[model samples]
Target chain A: MTALAIGIIIGCCALGAGIAMIAGIGPGIGEGYAVGKACEAIGRQPEAKGAVTSTMIMGCAIAETTGIYALVIAILLIFVAPGRFVDILTKAVRQIP
Target chain B: MQNSIQSRNPDRTTAKKPNKFVDFLLVLMMILPFAGCIALKVLFGNPGKGINVTGAQIYFTVKMPLQDMYITEGTAVSAAVVIALFALVLLLTRGLRRDPDTKRQLVAEFIVEKCDAFVEDNMGRGFLGFSPFVAAVMALSAFSSLSSLLGLYPPTSDISIVAGWAVVSFSLITFYKLRGGAWNYFRGFFEPIPLFAPMNVISELSTPVSMAFRHYGNVLSGYVVSTLVAAGLSSVSAALLRMLPGAIASFPLLRIGIPAVLSIYFDVFSGIMQAFIFAVLTILNVKNGFPEEEYERRMRKKQARRLEREGKKRPEREKNAA
Candidate 1:
């Protein structure tokens, strides 16, 4: 494989991981919105504090799953994908020769 | 008056200290996991010079027909420890009398009653029978996560452990829905219109996966952050202390005292909160799965049976029990 091809694969993997992490923005904003509403709810009915807090927590955790999924994908890109590209490219080169 | 009260209940005032041997055994149980971990680290572990943010360490692999089975260090050890802890609690609570003679019995009863009350409050009185199962899940999840504080590998840090529990809860949710009525349960997926069926199916399927990932991610992230912090601190300390004399320079001075503070949140707080969230989610999911009408019908039968026993106009509290 040419050096440029290897560099491009590595660069793309880096770019992909960085892009995948942008998925965190959605969860962050969503969770913040949920927490903001929950705060308003608890303020409106202080007696319902425990219920509101728990419900808010569950909602936030669910919201966080999207970011976690992104983290998993980014992890794969960094640790697994780059090596695969190189391995496949080298194998193809050997077969051609 | 306080003295009089104490005299009236001599057993409560003068309850014997737990047996010496039992106390020793309890301490031993707490210490054993940490000691075993340290010993293993000394003997067979190779934690290289970097932060270890990974899943359960594969302790061994067993041959299988189609594929090999990899056993992890975390799941096996934590499972044994948690089971043994449960057994020990059970053995201590054995042979209880009508009136509590020992504080141990009182404590055990307190736990059981509290578990029942939590279930009743959250999932309604119809779920009183589920209190034991709820308590078991809470205890298992909490213990597994808290084990990381002792330097033992946390079982819940591995996705498989949480995923297994999530799957169990998912099936229980399905079972409750089935009990409501098979036809209705299946047909409800098409609800309000047929075009929405695929969306409904996806939503239904997301429940378990979301639960598992939410929990596993939180706990694993906490573990990873704690590890990174410890490593970072060590490096920062080493850089600072390099100018010092030999032994002091080599030692990780910052690592000794700093990680414990972060650990309070990462290990203790996050562990407990995740366990609680998991339990609450399980209870809510199961409760919601059953049809509301079916629940009302079952509750009415229970109330009717209670009314027969009481032989009077049912009390206000009894009405709310529905």
Candidate 2:
């Protein structure tokens, strides 16, 4: 029973970590695309360099929002960890049943 | 090198992209710890299990044998060693002599020149005074962000660091206003609103706390989650994969692949974004000091100007004069 509880707790943490990282996919693709477009715009009108650069920066910043969300989740798991509680709970339940 | 700069055009392909090696190195710094964490998980057990709590397996250990000090996981000593090493490297790099004629040096020169151009084009030469502040804060945040991702103790994740940065920014604005005029700085705060002065003051005091907490909270969260995930998954896989024969033992990717994906999100994506957000917020706070006052002033001035153009004054102004 203790073994089963431990396994489940471990599995949840693994799954949670994976879920947190999934947030990165959006920004990775978005930032790359933004850089490409910004470069293209700069190529078209060098005179609009200021506008292009600022817009690009602003867009990239916005793209980072998801990453921040993921980071928050990751931090929560490490610092205020509750996985052990699950392990303990399951173990007690198993003992009773 | 000079020729490269001279011929360099933003529109032209002749302009070289920034060194990919540097980018790779920066990214590597963030992942190194995760790699270590995984290795430790397989060799030992999960270190983060009792990381911060009492009565838990002390994640860190130190032993002195034969007049030599040895340290183990979860010690501040580990962080100190890394910081000391980084500082040493920085010092060495600082002492290196660069040939102005070399391509690499030219690249550095080009970046500085581009930065100057950007500042001048947007905020003018007067803003150069603030350029160092901007560059320093951004660079530090970037480095800190990367370090966080790598599973290194990010100094920026500490409240002390965040508060320190906020204080620096706040002091700079205060000094600028002092030089500009006491009334100007005092007036600057009240420019946007005179009625809600108390609320403004409270927020002004709270900015440092919020700034620090925001950065620490975000980065710390990422570190914790990644650590848990790594610990849990590796233990499961270690047990499961052990049951398999030698053929399957060779390829642990079945277990590791999933954790790697999580690391990517927490380390790569969250790390960089949080750093950028911290830097951006720092810049914004500095730039938009007393925005409410500024807004109110503009509104009042516009009203007065409109009344003047119409050959009639606002009732408030008329009443004041009367």
Candidate 1 Cα outliers beyond 4 Å, as residue runs? A1-10, A38-51, A79-94, B1-38, B245-248, B292-322
**Looking at candidate 1, what is the lDDT of residue B303?**
77
TM-score of 2: 0.50
Q: Model 2 over residues B1-322: C-alpha lDDT tens digits?
A: 2444344423343334456576566456544644674454355555534334221123445565655432333333234435534543333223112234335455556655665565455455656555545655655665655554444455555555557777876676555435544566676556577977777788777766565665665655556566667667656666777868886653445445676687677666665665556555655555555344554565566778788899985687545743
Question: What lDDT is reached at residue B101 by model 1?
Answer: 77
Off by over 4 Å in 2: A1-97, B1-99, B148-151, B190-193, B235-239, B242-258, B290-322
Tens digit per residue, CA lDDT, model 1, B238-260: 99999999789978888997889
